[model samples]
Target: MTKGEQTRRFIIKQSAELFNQHGYAGSSLSDITLATGIKKGGLYRHFASKDEIAVEAFNYACQIVGGKIEEAVQKGETSYDKLMAYFRVYEHAAESPPFIGGCPLLNTAVESDDSHPLLRSKAQESSGRTLDGIREIVEQGRASGEFRADVNAEALAMLTLSLLEGGIMLSRLEGSNRPMQLNIESYSSYLKQFCLK
Candidate 1:
């Protein structure tokens, strides 16, 4: 990559955690410069404004979390296992998240809601992708006769996402993993209910 491209990525890498932890409105230009060791002019050279940087930074944060989830899901032997593995990622992340902050999607969703339109949309899209992934796994399981036909894939997917994200929030706030582990166990039990007997 050219120097410009490298610098842009460096800014994103350094600012991702800042943006995720601080939110779009909370993070300032100074924070970006401080984190990246790049001046305001340099940041402006790469990003048009804080809004632009925030959108990109949020994408980077999501990529970090998504990569781990994809890895876990791929390692599963069955659809049910894959769905469970997805939650396991969050459980582990409660202890050691990909970045300093917890789930970026959750962070951005709460921060951007009715605040930053661009960021709010990005967070929404990220959530849709997550739900889509879960639904896909459920559909696969149903096709393979591993899950019951009566199961509502979309609803289950949304429930899984909500529980995982909510669990992360509670765990982070409480400074304990018990809440996260409990959420995972609860979801696992729920998943089993739909498993073919």
Candidate 2:
């Protein structure tokens, strides 16, 4: 890549964790500059405004979380296993998140809900992608006779999404991994009862 492209990536890499941890309003230009070791002029050169940088940073954060889920899904041998693996990412979130903060999708969704329209939309799309991933796994499991044919893939996917994200939010709020760990175990149990023979 060109030097300019590399620099832009470097800026995003440096600023992603800051944004994820601080939220859009909380993370100031000074924080970004300090994290990136770039001056205000240099930041403006790469990004037109803080909003622009925030959008990119949010995307970067989401990509990090997505990468972990994707990695887990790839390691599973069956559709049921893959779905469980996806949820397992959250179980391990406190110990090994893709970034410093918790789930970026959840963080961005809550922080951007009323403040940044573009970011809110981005979070919505990210959520939709997550739901789609769960639905696909459920559908695949049913097709393979691993999950019950009577199960509603979309409904189950939505339920799984709610449980996992809610659990993560609670865990982060309470500053304990117990909530998420319980959710993971309960989710796995539900999966075994709902899908596996």
Candidate 3:
């Protein structure tokens, strides 16, 4: 890649944590500049505005998070194992989050719901994609006779995502992993109902 591209990526990489830790409105231009070690002029050269940089930073954060989940999911041979693997990715979120500030989707969704239209849209899109992925896994499991034929993939997927995200939120807020661990443990047992006899 060109030097310019590398610089842009570096900026995104640095700014991603800042954005994730601090909401878009909360993260000022000075914060971005400080995090990236780039002055106003240098930042403006790479990004047209803070909005553009925030969007890119959010996307970059999601990419890193998605990559980690995908890697874990790929290691499982069965759909149940795959779903469990996905949950396991965040098992220690409070202590060792996939990203520095926690789940970007959760953070962005909460912070941007009323204030940032663009970011809210981005979060919605990312959430939809995650739901779709989980739905696909459930469908595959049903097709393979691993899951019960009557399993409601859509609802199950939503529930799974909700449980995981909520768990992350609670865990992070309380500064402990108990909430996440409990959710994972309960979900694992609950998931057994979908298995074929």
Question: By descending lDDT, how would the candidates be arranged?
Answer: 3, 1, 2
Superposed model 1: Cα runs more than 4 Å off: none
Question: Could you give candidate 2's per-residue lDDT for residues 1-197 as a string of tens digits?
Answer: 99999999988877778878888888999999899889999999899998888888888888888998899999999987887776688775666655688888888899988888999999999999999999999898888888889989999899989998888888878778888888888888888887675
Report residue 59 deviation for candidate 3 (angstroms).
Answer: 0.7
Candidate 2 worst ten-residue window by lDDT = 90-99
lDDT by residue (145-189, candidate 3, tens digit) is: 899988899999999999999999999999999999999988888
lDDT of each: 0.87, 0.85, 0.92
Number of clashing residue pairs in every model? 0, 0, 0
Where model 2 places Cα greater than 4 Å from the true spot, the runs are none
Q: Which candidate number would show the highest lDDT if scored against the true structure? A: 3
Write down the lDDT that model 2 would get. 0.85
Q: Which scores higher on TM-score, 2 or 3?
A: 3
Look at candidate 2 and tell me the lDDT of residue 79.
86
